[model samples]
Target: MKSKKFILESRVKDRVGFQIERILENEKPHLSQGSNFLATIGLVEPFIGLYIKYSC
Candidate 1:
């Protein structure tokens, strides 16, 4: 079986991972530079399955 870290690393190298990172990076500046709620929501939004599924 593949190790968990290896699996995670591989996933990060693939299309979905790259797209996700791209989305967040693009959106990051709009939220706010130094606010708690903005930061919280920004990170939380990506985990919804629909977002990931539709985003790519």
Candidate 2:
């Protein structure tokens, strides 16, 4: 079995990957830094699921 630290690190990487994907996917012309910041913080609703699902 994997160690707790390893699993936690893996989940953190996955969460970051998920967030990056979300940011890139939703980015478009005329979008502001505030919008991207919101996406990064998971405040836009859809992006929060990854954190919820992968959280320890």
Candidate 3:
């Protein structure tokens, strides 16, 4: 079960990183402030998830 959870989290972090990289590369020039904020959120979300998961 722990291995499964770790795998899932790893996959999610990879996906998030990929999506943020895509957004920064493709849409950064035209992105508004709100979009930049969302991108920041994307980058931080995985850490937040891990914190919450282990804080219990």
Candidate 4:
């Protein structure tokens, strides 16, 4: 499996909302202010472990 790390922008800070924004910003096209929040954020290992009891 591949490492699922954020492709962080040089300009953006590494934090909750900004991390989510970076994910969306790297989409095939581009980002606007009104992009869907749910789609942008993703689940990575630490969060998955905190949320679920079983291995994925």
In terms of lDDT, the best-performing candidate is 3
Work out the TM-score per prediction. 0.36, 0.46, 0.49, 0.25
lDDT of 3 by residue, 18-43 (tens): 99999788876776748879999999
Please estimate how well model 2 matches the true structure, expressed as its whole-model Cα lDDT.
0.80
Model 2 regions more than 4 Å off: 28-56
Error of 3 at 30 (Å): 3.3
List clash counts for every candidate, in order.
0, 0, 0, 0
lDDT of model 4 at position 55: 50
Residue 42 in model 3: shift from native, Å? 31
Off by over 4 Å in 1: 1-13, 33-56
Ranking by TM-score: 3, 2, 1, 4
Compose the digit string of candidate 2's lDDT tens values, residues 1-56: 56998999999999999999888878854467577777766755665776787895
CA displacement after TM-score superposition, residue 5 of candidate 2 (Å):
0.4
TM-score of candidate 4 on Cα atoms, chains taken together: 0.25
Give per-residue lDDT, candidate 1, residue 36.
Answer: 81
Candidate 1: the clashing residue pairs are: none
Model 3, residue 36: C-alpha shift (Å): 19
